[model samples]
Target: MSTPDNNWEDHWRETLADHKASPPSTMDWGGMEELLEAKVAPLSPIKAPISSLEGKTLKLPGLPWPVWAIAIALVLALGYWLGSHTALGVSQEMNTIPKKTSLADALTPPADTIFDTLFSVGANGELTEEIISIERAIVNRTTAQKSPEINTSLPAGKSPSPSTPVNLNREKLKAGSNDIAPSTTPAVLLSEAKAPTTSPEFFTGIRRPDTPSSAPGLSYDLSSKPTVRPNRGGYVRPLKTLSPPTDRELLEQRIKALSLSEKLVITPLRYKNGHFPAYRPRN
Candidate 1:
């Protein structure tokens, strides 16, 4: 009896013998030869066309040098004109803006006058007296100049002395006063003239005779002083101290207490033993 290895070797030899005894394939070679000839036939003609194109140079129509120069000059002139126009417009805008006057310049008096010099009066009486004296001097001088009769009436030896008060008739004084133009007074003088109230400092520490000692409904006893409790230094300790569980510990506890139904609900859809839903076509 032959072993199983001898049986396998005999079967392989018979298969090899059958393969060697098979006849050669009868496929046609004429079509393949024709295809190869067609592919090689156009190679020589392609080089001839490529070489002919290399020798000739293509010429494009172009503007003359003078025409190009004229175009560049025109562009430069236009750019220069635009730049100058923009600069001129900017300068005109700047010129149109009114110059701002400084605060000090605006507040300052234009010319030094008598009122400007007398601005340092401490008391209202002195300021008023000085203003009145100046007004009287101006009135007298103006009246005397207009009335040539007053000057003629004075003796030739004495021109009117500035110290001597000119006593003119009341009617003449009134008429001359009307003719005299109103002078511009300082703002300080005008404000003081309108309202001559006493300063707040004048009323300091003075109590009114009719004022009540205390408010109508409110009173406090000053005879006795209230006692203050002493402060304890340290903070008070709480009766109970609680430390809440961490997120990880809580999660572990929750996992330990999970029910079968909850586990099934939490399980991934792919892991669950059920057929997937059928695909539905959209309407």
Candidate 2:
């Protein structure tokens, strides 16, 4: 607004310096530059761009190819094991087998107390003591009858009078003794009691006779041809033409495979006296 005069430049600079604020922490140019250069980033050799791993031969510092393969295989195996555990989960066992509950066990009423058992109930919903008195009387009668002193002393007199005595014949006493009662029985009674009561029912067990047997056997479709080959000719077949196996035969073959492959211990044939000489292969 005014012309340059009276050395105003130096005064303006002094006034701005007096009013100007100090640098803030974030805006400190010297500190920021120091930090950027020393602490934040240090200049080094420029690294080359990393190449793709697909085509390159992977050279792990010391580990061999099989080690990597083993590691991968272990990882895969672990993954498979984990996957299988997750997929199948734990096997359900019959740990809690269903208890066979009977109708008697399920529907039965709880056992009653002695008071409930003996007491009499009227239709008018009143509890009567009549049943209690009757029970008490029965108990008293039982107690009285069981006592020996009361029973023995009931009739008073120790000896019977001549008028009350009853006489027994000595001959009748000897003839009717306990051990030898002498009852008559026929000999044929035993055989008649043991005779078989049944006639016969067909289809009993695995072997049925053409003519009916005294005891029946098991049943099958007897009309069908035999699956088992008990041959008319002897066992004279070529090695190649050996019978085509059934599934059961295959299972038997699978079972025998372990034994067939197994080599017997090469033991020399020993006799009672000495070692026996080797026989001819054809024999």
Give, for candidate 1, the lowest lDDT window spanning 10 residues. 210-219
For 149-195, candidate 1 gives per-residue lDDT tens digits of 11123444453322233333222221222343222222223322432
Off by over 4 Å in 2: 1-18, 21-59, 90-283
Q: List the residue pairs that clash in candidate 1.
A: none
TM-score of each: 0.19, 0.16
Error of 1 at 22 (Å): 60
Local error of candidate 1 at 20, Å? Answer: 56
TM-score of 1: 0.19
Name model 1 segments beyond 4 Å from true.
1-62, 95-173, 177-283
